[model samples]
Target: MRTTRRWWVPAVAVAVIAAVLPVTPATAQPVSAGPGPVVADGVTQPVFGYADAIRERIFVTSDVDTDADGALDVVAMDIIRPRASEQGLRVPVVMDASPYFSTVCRGNDSECKADLDGDGLNDRWPLFYDNYFVPRGYAVILLDMIGTNNSTGCPVTGGRADNISAPTGIDWLNGRRKGVDAEGNEVVADWHNGRTGMIGKSYDGTLANAAAATGVDGLTTIVPISAISNWYDYSRSNGLVTRANNYSGSLANNVTNPDRRQYCAPVRTQLGQGGDDATGDYNDFWAERDYLPHAGQVKASVFVVHGINDDNVRADHFSKWWYALAEQNVTRKLWLTGTGHIDPFDFRRAEWVRTLHRWFDFWLHGIDNGIMREPAVDVERLPDVWETHADWPLPGSRPTQVFLRPGTDGGPGGLSVRSGPGNRSATFRDTPTMSQATAIRHPSDSSANTENRLVFLSAPLTAPLHISGTPIVRIKASVDGTDTSFAGLLVDYGTRERFSTSGDGIQTRSTEDCWGEAATFGGYAEEGCYRQTVKTVASNPQELVTKGVVDGLNLDSLFVSTPLVPGAKYGVDVPLMPEDYVFETGHQIGVVLLGSYSGYSSRAKQTRSQITVHFDSTRITLPVVGGRQAAVAAGLG
Candidate 1:
């Protein structure tokens, strides 16, 4: 039920395959035994030259006139392929179509696309994709998103204009769309085999999601790292606007800065209205930007990489998308880490590049590398330690409900497998002035300042308890006023060292390592080398596993608003953020309920509204790794 629309067509018009891949001669290292690029082991070799790769600039037309210029928009594309493609070698494409190429830089190093000669062709490419992949017989295209950097139109975050930018270029590569050069001369991807794989981080990755969702033919695979699939989930959650006013417009403006977005002033204003910050409801405006409902349209295989601790894009985006993809029987893979909004190339460097190379070879070049035969998921649960699984949520993972009980002698309540006494209930006054941390932590303080929240804890775990998926907290509560919000935090109460979401959770090492090939422009050597990073860790008494907050009016549905009556209980189902965390032995599970969570929302107008909870009717259903027996064995009962 995650998706209601069927947007994917069963059959797409794919390009005809005519050419057969050539094999390289064996040398000191292992070479190709069959078709496709030369492989030493499972990965393709850097046989094609990069320093003299065929680099050119072109434009592809797209639908919509975002700038109100009365003409269809054109996206600026910069292509880099192996010079061997100029001969008779037909190579696959790897594209990083990005909106950040102009206004903002990407990754920890803050790198951006550079055009030294101002001729639309890039003098320097961001990241190491070009240096690494071009030599491996793949073409890496750096696309300037519509309305930014030599492209025409306005950038409206996840709207149609922004989503189709990459797909149109894919169409051009497949000879289905018109493309022109710097002098307006027609240009066709004559050397391309019509197999394309999109990869990027953040907004760039977001475009990859958009492209795959369009069911665009010839797009064989996508590696979306820390990307957003639903814009509504990005800015709003269950009728609560999580971001500032006009977030879509502000984000659009930021990505197209330095006067490129000048003529798109009116378009920006319209985008602000489309967000509907005041009501925070799902409407047609949000529908155009949401890719979740259209998840069935995905035809390409997905290799999803996301930070489990990424609050910017949130983990729910990937989890929900994965669920939808699973329902559609889409081939997929997952990589979950303990870092923030960062690319795996920076953290997991060696493995990521190697795995990614094999992935592209298998999908784009049809190399039959047996990547799909491997485990479907790689999870980094304990800091640097990693484990592989058949799929996410684990095979034995199932829903386990835990009841929230009241304190016996006016202390903290308990979490039990059996339902608590129906007669008892807890109440907390709305406190917008208090921080979310103060509301959830320090339950033993006995201070009146913390009375604005209710805390529930379970007995210390005797065994490791794994919470592998999304946790739903269904509460029957009554608020004194209609303008109140509620929040719940799933906590791991134990003193230990863990990865913190603060910063990038890394320290820059002195040694620098290079990826792919080096380049020089105007005697300046761009060695493609980068300083390595080590994951940072922090020790704390407790770690916040996941959180969920909701506006009191959105008890039933996100699109519908129902006002809460005074002293009338209503069922409020709050789904916490998706998480893959393990509570070790001796650690306790904690849940905190607060009014007006100040850390996420600012709509707690008066902060005087008090909430009354019904203990018997409220329960948290967690997707536990081993189901009910696992909870009881961990001492929850």
Candidate 2:
């Protein structure tokens, strides 16, 4: 074991928007078309040489000292830029800040930061940013999240140390801060063209969100893939402890450099205590990690990406963040892929690179690319099918309401558009022993349903059913105890192929697709390239579209808990993640109610108290295309 748990790393998006006009470069240096990138055909040309691109390391001091060590912590910034930067040519930057540079890796290929020649410097940058973008006049920087790798400080999960560390690189680039070489000699980013773009997946992406939320100057754009906007949402669901207690601390300790682990032990203790898993209430700790509150301050143009099938980070992270950015009317674009926690570089490949290139050029290089003029999103409906939508919630989309009706003697219920067969109630006891996999397994089979879960299925759809945007499920139920947990799952029942989680949908060929600057170690290929995933036929009868869970007492307030009156009816809301799916003809939409869900959150504890569903008014609101009429026409009734 290199360290603890499944070590994570970072993702990089879809669609190419052709430039609206070919203009002179006007990015960092304010010269024509700016810096040294050769512009042709509305995009930056790869005319710069990758072999001699200047590669070096520097330490950018951060504003935080999590350990109370008096001195500010310094983050490790590894750089690889076009050699033109060393001369009079300046360039914009694309940076990814991640903790996995030390212990974990990224993507399906398990790629990590490497020192190919062991020169104590990163020779082989993870992914293809350095290999592909360095030659295109973009300085690709990989920052070692403070407290990990060669950076100084303690990893505080998403606290100031983690959230505020990486942006120092931006600060240095913009002349807001000064960096130093290994020997402590002052180093200034005089070569930096003022504009910068941050890109990453998972925790790496979370940092980008944090950086943008700060409204930091010079950070003109960000491409956050499968990222988090709120730390509390990552650990809890509707004020219920879904992840294990002390997860914040555990994760902090997991990513910290081994040498400094002991020094940061106290900080880890505080992080765990601050999470307040016992009550699972939002507190100062989670507030510090949340970026949404600061969304109003963001000035960067966001190019956000998320995996619709991703269960690890979940789709809610993107949905909430998207809405927040939208409310602020911030310039933004989105990409929803069918892959689970996978990068577009691996899933979409060439298109991702091209669109990302255009996005950086548009935002960072001040290019007149019509990327913003293009559809706001490129959404993947299937492995081979992608659609470009003008924006989220395709036009005429609205929340369609659906209700649960009684079944034949506790077998399974039917979902109906007609409401108020009122006063009819369905009941089920809490089954803590049932795993989430078993609870939601194969909804088409009646054997999968028991007293542990209440399954409701809609009629076969006569027309196509398209669901986009966030869906909300509110349960009108009563429980036996003062507090209990509930789970609601939205299911798609039909035979179709979807993104496979267990690699059954992909086959590794003997031939490998090589990439990067072609640097190799003693025997290993350190060019950040490998032959990984390929699409294969994968099908299933039923798939989990989304799920939401909540604690009864915390439904109204995540920061406070209210004990329930025995056998009293109350509306318990389960915040389902966002989704973009199209249910074909003959497919049925299903909803499952459970006492808890281990499938969604592995550590979610089951509520042992009995729970009941009052069929009178409980309903789920789906963002279905064409609203109620389309839902009725599609058999969503």
Candidate 3:
């Protein structure tokens, strides 16, 4: 794939405040207001777009009872339905509470609650709701879930135990005369009408996941974007406890200061943070109420999307659900890019809108538009390259392993795989080499505690190997201290620069169940622990760090995820942590020996902790492909 360089232009996040000015007695709560011919404003804004025609004024009905008392004695909503068509009917609904009425919507910035787009019309709730749900030719239903703005009651973001509002929303639609189906059936009149699909980003995405998990009647499809599926993984990656960035405790601060305590109280209760409780596991109360468990049970199809470089929620979430869905044999699609959390600025907004319209048309309209038949995975690699794979990891990739070995020459000595378990180790001088830009360990050396790295190489491959999938690095190691940390890096030896070809998807292969589904290529048979899938070999240099971890006197194997390239020679480099460590007088640094890839390196960057790993037995695990093995499987010569 050819890479192109494009400057990233992030959209400015404008804070929109609500228009909470007191209504004059002259133009108070309306009795009857006709649909007006509202003209567009001259100003153009970043997020707000122009529509061919605006439904100007909606004569919505509303009720309000001012009190902190636990009584939702109010109702308000605008009706926006598509004109009945000769072919099919479409309906959509949008909802938001306070900000649409009061100035403090979503905690900060009253402008966000007003006419955010500067369209000369207030659409705080309208546009935000339609951004995700209302496609062309669909009837729209907007509800004041808790009846905040013009309505009354506790506006449920998605729903509540006592008030499963999402299904209630569907109920409202089917009850409308215009929403009835062919058999003279009021679509929303019955609770058993077809399921309702909920879609949105950020707050809306989380609610969709919650509604889907609740298994509410008439709740069919929910598309949760940039949301946390497993609360534990969301708070903890691998097994390490992460800073509580996405939880209620961190977010409650944003709500409290603004006196939006109305929204805060219910959200905190739902998160279980206010009740001296812990919402920890995937099986816990919060997850039960919100988490979409088995991908197989997703009765409603989901088009999961996420930004790879999201500082808020992280893109690892996409991997979690994508693998789960694949395991459940469910067909789902993913759109992954390197962008900020709130806005997917990776692609133009129009492209995103078009894709969603096509998706909604196929599933909601029953148009047989063949959108579902598209590729399962679409990824945007860095620099710039958008690719579509029939399936993740692409197809026809073969497995090839490059052993990490100690070497006297700058090049890593080529190591080979054996029929049974085997081990080897090598040592290199502690000194800095190569440009600082490509160095794995920083600050080269500190005091007499010298730090050094090794570079091992693999013999050139004879064939054009396709290595588009994931590969594993196995290293057996032991350390001299009570604690140690190991890290791995794959490098290309053919080019003088020793660049790394390990792309976005390549990762350390620990348990085979990494992908869950059994891949036909990799000779490594499937097991319950398998979690990921790897592809074949390419014609570039390759290398892998078999292990990187910190522990005492442990004989374990580590797996490093690094793909390989054919023809060009490959190599491995393992640097002692002291090379990157700042030795504090009393603290001692020790190299850790390992046989497997460690998650220690992954979190070390986040936690800013020092770690070192010493390697003892390092070997390569190659999936035998095409030779005798392929012939035996296919009965070919």
Candidate 4:
């Protein structure tokens, strides 16, 4: 690493360069050196050459030992900006602090290789931010987050150390924190205006959410796509463990320095102990990582984008975060899609880039782009169509509870408003080996009539039924065992083909699609093209809408567990996955109840105990457009 002091270029030299440079859509006009700011049109600007305008360096953070070592950690920072910045033109910063730079790469690439050039910098930068934003008068910084790549320390997953590390970088840019280069020399950021915006996908985006939640002074806004708001929710649900392995310790070890893994053994042990897989209850460790609790501290505007059908992070994360931000009156916008675990770059390239440009300009550059005046929510209704609303769940939508009733004869149950016989009940044996697909299949299927699950169906809809928010399943049930896992699925039963947002649906290809102003550099592959079609392999007759799970011991609270007493009935409310979807006319809405879901949780020993649900006391509440009237018109009331 190398260090340098603040340096400035002569005003006269910049003026001469501006006079000779050409002005075109494909090339940036030279900016004159002056004390005042020069605003570049974010929509149209040339792609600046990386070699001419970019500089790479390392910034050793102030005294905060993430690895429990005596010394502080160093973060790798790579910057790209307009060359005119050296001539006194200050600009706002757009940053992405990520750990994947070394472990998994940023975009479609599966693995990231450490291909360093002679200058001790990565030859290829991840993502399109550097390729597109530098010419538009924004400083783009690619930081190898605190414990990965060239940064010194051990990764702690989403612990307090990891949650606060990225925000410290914002403090450094605002001149509040001290930083130095790799050679034990002082380094300073003299060119930035101290206003920053962060953006990324998945874990990279989670860092942005965490940093913004800190209420860091200079952070203007954040864009978190398919990001996690709580680590415990990502790995567990209501006392039910989703993963068998210890994720916190495993991920920490994966991102730590190869040679220093043994040195961080104690930290890994601490992570495993804090996770507490046996109970899966919320603790201080998860609370520190829960950004929702800290939303009140956020001053930065939030622009959220998430796939409604994303099972990995789940829509609950974004929905809960959005509601919390609303309570704090934080500026916010949302784009909900029908895709899963995907970035907007791959889902809708051209529109996303244009929207993002305007968003950054309005928040970071003080440009009135009318982005704030527009509708607050834009949701994908189907495969490629979109609908804009004043806010999420629509203004007129109401929560309507649809009751579950036993079949007239010896058939499956029905979803209706009328109550069934008081003595009617459905029983199923706890089977930990049943897959989600088998559990939710239509009751007519011979394979679905097993003793492991109970299926209920609604009559064919007379009109289209649209639901736009989280659905809750309220049930009165008794079990023979002390504790058992409960899984509930809301499904659509029809023959029409739909976008496959589930993980098992699609097989992406090696093809690409071109968008935006074309770039002719590096074989025309820089920011010009992305995957054309997120290929869909449709399922016939039935498709899963959303699912939820809970442990009987957690019926009262997620933070505390109380084992159920055998033969005692309990009323439990299980929140199904949040969704924005429409069931076409003639299609039926179905609900499936199972004892356990092997896909989302570890396979426990077979309980072989009977679980009985009282039909008259069980119901599901959905967010419908016109409440019971709409449901009645659709033959569901």
- In candidate 2, stretches whose alpha carbon ends up further than 4 angstroms from where it belongs are 1-35, 114-120, 441-450, 504-510, 519-528
Better of 2 and 3 by lDDT: 2
Please list the residue runs of candidate 4 whose C-alpha ends up more than 4 Å from where it truly belongs after superposition: 1-44, 47-50, 110-115, 408-410, 445-450, 501-531, 535-539, 603-605
Q: Give a tens-digit lDDT track for model 3, residues 1-637.
A: 1111111111220111001111111211223322211112311111211231122222221222223455533333343332231112222233322213342343111223233454433444323333333323343344333434433343322224213334344434434212322233422322111335566555546555554554444444455667656554444332222344334444433423344455556555544442122212223333333354645555555667765545456555555565565665544666765343533322324455556655554444333444555676566543234667565434433444333444333333334332222333443221222222233232113221222344333344333222233233444432222322234443323312211233322333343221111211122221112223232123322222112222111122111112222222222333211100011222111122222222322223222112222234454332233323431232111
lDDT by residue for model 4 (241-324), tens = 787667888888887767778987788888888888878888887888788999999877788999887878888989888878
Candidate 4 or 1, higher TM-score: 1
Work out how many backbone clashes candidate 4 has.
Answer: 0
Point out where model 1 deviates above 4 Å: 1-36, 118-120, 448-450, 522-524, 602-606
The candidate that achieves the highest TM-score relative to the unseen native structure:
1
- Residue 12 alpha-carbon offset, candidate 1, angstroms: 21
Candidate 2, residue 241: the lDDT equals 78
The order by descending TM-score is 1, 2, 4, 3
TM-score of 3: 0.53
Error of 4 at 344 (Å): 0.7
Worst 10 residues of 3 by lDDT: 13-22
lDDT ranking from best candidate downward: 1, 2, 4, 3
Provide the TM-score for each candidate, comma-separated: 0.93, 0.91, 0.53, 0.89
Worst 10 residues of 1 by lDDT: 7-16
Across 1-637, the per-residue lDDT of candidate 2 in tens digits comes to 0111111111111112113211212222433333467888888888777777777799988888878899988888898888777766777889999988877776566677767667766755677788778778888999999888888888888987777776788777766677788888977776776777899999999999999988877777889999999999898878877787799889888888777889899998998888987788999989999999999999777888988777788788998898888777777788888777777776777788889988888776767666656777788888858998777756667888877777765567787677858878877777767775676666645554556788888888899989887788878999887767788888888889877766523456556665546544334554646665676556888887888888777867888988889899898777788888888899888898987656756656555787878988888888888889988888755
- Number of the top candidate by lDDT? 1
